[model samples]
Target: MTSQTTEATPDGGQLRVSTLELFFDLVFVFTITQLTHVFVHHPGWDAVAQIALMFGVIWWMYSGYAWLTNEVAPTSSGRRGLLTLGMFGFFVLALAIPDAFHGSGVAFGLGFVLVTCVHTALFASSGGSSAITAIKHIAPFNVLSAGLVLVGGFLHGWPQYLCWALALACQIGSPYLIDTSGFEVRPRHFAERHGLVIIVAIGESIVSIGVGLTGRDLTVGLVANVAVGLALAYVLWWAYFGIDDERGEHALSAVPPRERSRPALFAYGYSLYPMLIGVTLAAAGIQMSIAHGNERASLAAATALSAGVALYFVGQWAFRLTLRLPRPWTRLVAAAVVCLTIPIGVAWVAWAQLALLVAIAYAAVIIDDVITLRTGHHSSYV
Candidate 1:
C-alpha cells in the first residue's frame, strides 16, 4: 500500500500484468472448481441463489484486488509478499465453499474478511489523500459487511441468507457510495487483468469436462460428448476473445481520465458478474451432461446447459453496450435459440443436447465472422 504510485503509474508506458498477478490468479481456479461442484450437486433454485451470493462475494474479492494491483505496483518484495498472503486467504475461502451453507460458514466468512482487510490496507497506503479518503469511506463498510458475513455464518436458513445478502449489498453499492475521482486506473492493466480472469474461468469450464469424464469407461458416445464439450468451450472462448477482447481494452483506454470509472465499472466490473456466472453455469452443465452421457437429460440439466450458453451471449451483448459498441444480432439471436432448445434438449439425450448447444454457439461465431468479413466491421449492428 505504501504509495508506490510513482512506480505503479502507467506514465512509464503501457502497464502490463505482472507475473505475480498471474500467480495470484491460480487461486481462483480452485474457487471456480468448487463452485461448479456445488452447482452440479445442488441445482435447486435455493442452491443457485446461495451460489450466486457466494460468487458475488468472491468476485468482489478478486476484482477488488485487480483494482488494487492496477494502482499499486507489487514490485517490492514486501508488496509481493503481501499479495501472496492475500492469495492464501482466497485459497482458504475456496476450501470453504462446500460447507459455506452449512458446516464451515465461519471459515468462509473469515477468509473473505481477511482478503478484504488486505485490500483495505493496500488502498490505505497506496495513493495520496484520495486513496486515504477512499479507505476511510470504504474500509468501514468493508468491516461492517465482513461482520454481517460472520454473523450470517452463525445463523441458518433464511436468516443466514438475509445477512449474506445485506453484506453483498454493502460491497456492491460501495463504489457508488465513495468518491472514486481521487483514484487512477491504468486502462491497459485493468482491462488485461479482467480479460485474463475470464480466460481462467474458461479454463475452469474445460477442466470440468475432463473432471466429469475422469475414470469413466470410454465409449464412442462419451468420446463424442467430450468433443462437443470442448467445442462448446472453444466457441465461448472465440465468441468473447475474437471481437470483444482487444476492443474492450481500447474502449477503456479511450475514455477520458475523469470519466473512466463509469465505463470501467460497467464494462468490466458489473458485466463480469453475468460473464462469470454464465461460465460457471456452463461448466456445471458440461459436468452434468458429460456424467450422464447417452442418457436422456432432465429438465434441470437441459436448462442449465442451454441457459448457461444463452446467459453468456446476453453477457457479451451487455459488455458491448457498456463499451458503447454495437451489439451483434447474431449473439442475441443465439441466446434466444439456446433458450428455445431447453424443451428440445429435455427430450434429447445428454450428448445430443450438448451437441445442439455447441452448434448454437459455433453458428453464432461463424455468422459473426461472416458479417465481419462482408462489412469490414466486427459487429453487424455497427
Candidate 2:
C-alpha cells in the first residue's frame, strides 16, 4: 500500500495546499450551509440524526479527497480537472441536501455516485503504485456504498435510514478493511488542509449571526446577542487553533509515515463530523435566538444552542484522545453542565442562555489551560 512514486512537493520542503483546492472549498462552504439549513429547519433530536446520517456520508468523501490530495497533489492540469469534477459532484450533493430525505434523494444519490467515481478514477489514474494498489483494495467498498445510497433513494422511512447508515458504515470502516500501512500522509499538507476546512466550516457561525440581523432594527439586546455569539465562536476557535491543531500535526509528524494513517483516521477523518455538525447546529441556534431576541427560545433552538456546544466539547475530547494528548476531563464536565442550561433557554430569554454557553465554554478553556500548565504537560513545541 505504500506509494513508491516518491513525488516531491512544489516547494520541495512542505507540500502546501494548492489554489485549486481552496477554490474547491467554496463548494464545501456551500455544503456546510445546506447542512446548517437542515438543522435550522428542524432543530431537535431528529435534526441530530439526519445531520449525523447525511454528514457522515458527505464528510467521508470530503475526508477521502483530503487524503487523496495529500498523496496525489493537483500539480498538473489533468489532476486539477479531476478535482474540479469532484467539486461539481459536491455542489450537486449540496443542492439536493435540503430535500434529500424527501423528493431529492435520487439527486443526492447521483451526486454521491459521481463523487465516488471521480475519487476512484483520480486515485487510480494519478496516484502512485502504492496509491493505486490501495484504491484497488478500497474502491469496491466505495462503489458499494454509493450503490447503497442510490438504493436508499428509492426506499423510505426506516429502510432509507438503514441503507444510508450502511453506506456510512462502509466508509467509516474502509481503513481497517485493509492495512493502511501502505497509505501515505503528507503530514503538514494533510493537517493544514483539514484545519482550513474546519476553520471555514466554523466561520459559518459568524455568518449565521449576521443573517439573524436581517429585517431588524439596531437595538441593545440584538447587540448583546451578537457579541455573545461571536465570543462563543472565538472560544471554539481558540479551543482548536490554540493548541490542538498544532498538536495534531505534531502527532502525525512524530509517527512513522506508514503508521500516520491511524492517528490521521481517528483524529481528522472521524472526529471532524461531530465538530462540524456542532458548528452547524450552533450557527442555526444563534440565528434563531438573535432573530427573536426578546422571546424564550423554542425547544429546537434551545437544544441547538446547548447541545451544539456540548457536542463540540465531546468531539474535541475525542480528537485529543486520538492524538494521545493530555487530559480533557474539563471538556466532558463542560459538556454536561452546558446541557443543563437548555431548559434555561426554553424558559428564559435567549440571550441569557446564550451568555451562559459562552461562560461555560470560556471556563472550560481556562481550566484546561491551568491544568495543562500545572501538570507540566508542555510536550508539543508548536
Candidate 3:
C-alpha cells in the first residue's frame, strides 16, 4: 500500500500537472457553479445545510481522484479513458445538483456511486500488492456509502438528508477508520490539485455576479457593484496566492514517509472543506446583493456575505497551521471585524455593505504585507 515510487528525490524536482489532469478539472468548474446556484435559488438554513453536505460529497470524491493521480500518472491511453469516464460521471453529478434533494436524487446518487467505483477499480488495478491491499481496506466502506447514497435518493424530507449525511460521514471517515499508512501522496501534485480546485471555487463566485445580472439592463449602480464584487474576489485570491503557494507541498515533503498521511488528510482533505464552503457562501451573497442592488439587504444576505469572509479567514488559519507556518493574524482580525460589522451594517444598502467588506479584506492584506516586510519573511512561489 505504501508507494516509495511517488516520493520526490533529494534534488527537489517538482511534479508537473499533466494535460489530462487539467481536462479533468474542467468538470469541477461546473460542479462548483452548480453548487453556488443551489444557494442562489434557495436561501434558508435547510438550503445551507444541503449545500454544505453536497459540497462536501463533491469535494471528497474529487480529492480522491486527485490523490489517485498523484500515485498513477494519467498518461496511458487506458488511464486517460478511465479519467474521461470519470468526467462524465462528475458532469451528471453536477447536473443533478439542482434536484439532489428532490426528484433527481437517484441520478445524483448513481453518479456518486459510479465515480467512487471507478476510483476503487483504478486503485485495485495498481501495480503493487500493497495497492490491492489498500483497496481491500478502502472498498467496503465506499460500497456501503454508495449504497446509502442510492437509498437516500428514494427517501424524502429529513429522512433523505439523514441518509445522505450518514453516507458522507462514512465516505469521509473511512480513511481514518481503516489503516491507510501504506498509502502515499505526492506532495506537489496533491497541493497543486487542491489549489486548482480553490481557483475553480473562486471562479464560481465571479460567475455568480453575471448570473445575478442575467436580464437586467446595466446601470451605473449595477456596474459599480460588479466592480466591487470583482475587487472582493481579487482580494480573496491575493490572500491565498500572495503567501507561499507551495508552502503546504514543501511542508508535506518534509514529513517522514510513515507520517505523511495524517497531515495530508487533516490539512488538504479536511481543512480545505471550509475554504470551499466560504467561496460558495460568498458567491451566494454576491449574487443576492447584485440582484438587490440599491435596496436594503436582508439579514440572511448580510450574514452570508460577512460569514463567508470570516469562514475564509478561519479556513486560511487552519491551512497555515497545518503547514506549521506563522499564524495569519491579519486574516483572523479581518474575520472578527467582518463578524462584528454585520449587525451594525444591517441598515446599509447591500452594495454599500459589500464595499465595506471589501475594504476590510484589503486592510488585512495590507497589514499582513507590512508585517512580512518588517520581519523580512516575505516570500513568493511561481
Candidate 4:
C-alpha cells in the first residue's frame, strides 16, 4: 500500500519530496568521496577532530537544505534554483577540503562560507521567521571561519593550525544554535529520504569491494573475500531498513513537533555516523584484502565494520523503544547482530576464516527472519 500526507506550512501546503529531490542525491556522490578521502589519508587521532567537525558541518548544511526543500519546494521555483546553486557550492567545497586546513585553507574556508550564503538564500527565500533565525545562527560561524581562513592565508605551522581548530569549533556548534524545536518533518518522507542515502552508502561499499577485487588473480581467497564483504553489506541493510525504519517513522509521526525533533535528529542525522563509518571501514578492508592479504587486519578497519554492525542493532533497539514496540522478533534481530560481530573478530586468528564465518553469521540472521515469517510469528511492531 502507498501512503501520502500534505504538510501544512506557513507557505501553501505542498507534497514533501519529489523527483528533483531524489535526483539531488547525486551531489552526495562527490561528498561521499570527499569524506572517504579524509579518512583514508589520515584515519588517526589528529584527523578525528577535523573529521568529526567537518562531518557535522556537512550534515548541518545538507539537513538544512533538506528541511527547507521539504517545506518550500514544489511551491516555489526560486527555492529550487537556490538549492541547485547550493549543490554547486557543495561541489566546490568538496574539491577544496584536502587543503582546507593546510596552505589552501583560504580556498577551502571560502568555499564553505559560500555554501553558507547559499543556505542563507534558500531559507530566506522560504519566507519564514526561522529563515532569519537560521541565518543569524549560522552566519557568524561562517564569517568567523572565513576570518580564520584569511589569517591562515599568510601564517604557517602552528598559527595556521590554531585558526583551523577555531573554525572547526564554530562549524560543529552551528546546528545547536539553529535549534530543532517546532521544525516540521513529515515522517515517512524523511525516513524514505535518509533510507535512500543509506542505500547509496551501501551501494558505494559494493562498488568499493568490486573495485578492490577487479583485475586481480581470481583465487579462492579473493572470491571468498568478496562474498564476505557483500554479506556484511546485506546484513547492515536488513538490520536498519528491514525493521527499524518503519518503527522510527511511526514514532516520529505520532509526536508533537517540539518533542519529535530531537529523536529525528538522533535517529536520522546521527545514524549516518555509523552507516558512513562502516562503509569507509569496509572499503579499507577491501583494500587490505586486495594488497595480497599480506598484512594483519588493522584495528581501525575491524573497529569501523564492527561499529557499523553494532550501531544497526543499537538503532533497531532504539527505534523499538521510542515507539513502545515490544515485539519478540525485534529482540531476536538485535541478538543476531551481536552474534554477527564474532566473525569480524575472528579476523585476528585467520583472515580467510574470518570472511567465511562472517558469511555464515549474516546468513543466519536472514534465515532466522525467513523462518519467523514462515511460522506466522511475524508481527507488526509499530
Which is the leading candidate under TM-score?
Answer: 2
**Local distance difference test scores for all models:** 0.80, 0.83, 0.79, 0.59
The Cα error of candidate 2 at residue 218, in Å, is 1.2
- CA RMSD for every model? 3.6, 3.7, 3.9, 5.0
Cα lDDT of model 2 by residue, 1-382, tens digit: 1232334465332277767678888998988888888888876676677778888999999998988888787767788798899999999999999888888989999999999999999888877777789889989999999999999988878898899999999988888888776568888888888988888888889989998788888788788788888998899888888778877788789998778888888899888778888888888888888878678999899888788888888888888888888776667788899898888888988888898888988888877877777876553421
Clashing pairs in 3: 1-130, 1-182, 2-182
lDDT digits (tens) for residues 248-329 of candidate 1: 8788788887778777877787888888888888898888778787788777778878888888888888888888765556
In candidate 4 the C-alpha lDDT for residue 204 amounts to 64
**Clash count of each predicted structure:** 1, 2, 3, 0
- Model 1: number of clashes? 1
What TM-score would each prediction reach against the true structure?
0.93, 0.94, 0.92, 0.76
Order of candidate numbers by TM-score, starting with the best:
2, 1, 3, 4
Q: Candidate 2 local accuracy as lDDT?
A: 0.83
Q: Specify the highest-lDDT model's number.
A: 2
lDDT of 4 by residue, 248-315 (tens): 67767887865766677666765565455555545544443443443455555444445445544554
lDDT of 3 by residue, 1-382 (tens): 1232334333222265666777788998888888877877888788789888887877887887877776667645786688788889899889999889979899988998899888887777752465567768988988888888889888889988998899889978898788876667668777877888888888888998998899999989889999999998988888887764556778889998668877888788887888888888888888887877688777777788788888888888788787786655656778888776566346868887888889988888777767766877665632
Off by over 4 Å in 3: 1-14, 127-129, 328-330
Which parts of model 1 are misplaced by more than 4 Å? 1-14, 328-330, 378-382
After superposing candidate 2 on the true structure, give the runs of residues whose Cα lies further than 4 Å from its correct spot. 1-14, 374-382
